[model samples]
Target: MLFSLVKKDLLLAKKYLMFMTIFSFVSPLLIASRSSFSDTGFVSLLITVLLTEYILYISISSLEDKSKGAALLCTTPYKRNGVIKAKYLLILIIFMCCFILYTILTYLGISPNIQQMSITKIGTIMLVLSIFFGILIPVQVKFGYEKTKYIGFIIVFLTPFVLPNLIKWYTSSNLSINFTISLSQNIYGWIPFVLSLIIGYISMQVSIRIYSKKDL
Candidate 1:
């Protein structure tokens, strides 16, 4: 039943996936060619892949709202918990696919220094998705995407800017919060993955309860 819901989402967002695949290959070439990049463009690779999928998932909510899909789903025979689980799982699965796509391209001898997509890199990606899902889903479920649209835009605009600065600050600052995410694979690789799992789990539970109570 959960699989069916995921399939429905995939079907509805087929065009987004189609567009993502094209960028998956093309963006790497462009980023690798740019002069201002360090980490040999791997930063760009991760950001581009993540932002593309993040926007697509958020767009799905907007689409669902426009079509009254969530309101209708609430009236269906399906369990509300299943709807929440499948939605969260869908984001995880798409993130894995994008990671794998880049990994394979680099494995085939493509450069930009993506020789291997590290556990920490993938973990950080999941953390980003988890944060967005944790905030976006409950508000969206409770208020509908129409009410959440501006919040989503602000988030979308702010995230890319904020994440990099946070990374820079953590990497360079003398504060007690001394941690470099890019190098965490050695010291704290598992932290982001574990934290994201915890966060995503809690988010799912919250969404389930919110969705179940809503009169939609």
Candidate 2:
């Protein structure tokens, strides 16, 4: 039942998925051209942008039918929790597609060097994305689609501008300057990543709970 709901949703969203695929393939080339073939920042920025776009697009697409009352997925035999799980499943699949595309581009020399990749950086990126998605999904479920879209847009636009400066301020004033990254070759790199994952998981659970109780 859950699978059926997911399939229906995906069928409706196929056009967007196709767009994402084409974008993923072209992203590396675009980044390379923009950066004058500078590998690191361009690839990182491209990956970040691609992931953000896909996450938002999928979230919006998934809720479209529900918002319009054109379909009855929310009223199916599947538990609301199962419906949510299906979303995560679809998201993971889409995310994997992006990862694979990026990997191929890296290998083909259109992207950055794979060997220079920092697990910490990747983990941080995933954590940020998880938090963004986690916050947005439940809000969409509770408040309906249009309001959530505005809220999501505001957060996405503001966060990149806000976070770095906030971080710099905090670090500069702190005496210890203690910050951690996950997956550093040294023993401590995993701390921030693990912590972020935990937070992301908790945020997801909260979103699920909110969604489960909503009148949709």
Clashes of 1: 0
- Candidate 2 residue-pair clash tally: 5
Question: How accurate locally is residue 153 in candidate 1, as Cα lDDT from 0 to 100?
Answer: 76
The lDDT of model 2 is: 0.59
Report the lDDT tens digits of candidate 1 across residue range 66-164: 898877887889888898999888888787777777777787876645556567766776787788778888887888877877886786667556655
lDDT of 1 at 66: 81
Top TM-score: which candidate number? 1
Off by over 4 Å in 1: 35-37, 40-42, 158-188
Model 2, span 1-216: residue lDDT tens: 667766866776765767767777675456445442223443444354545465545455546645653235566566667767666556545555666676676677754433234566555555566666666666666776766666666665665445445555655687565456554475564654686668656766776797777765
Against the reference, the lDDT scores of all candidates come to: 0.75, 0.59
The local lDDT score (0 to 100) that residue 95 gets in candidate 2 is 57
**TM-score of model number 2:** 0.71
Q: Cα miss at 83, model 1 (Å)? A: 0.9
Clashes by residue pair, model 1: none
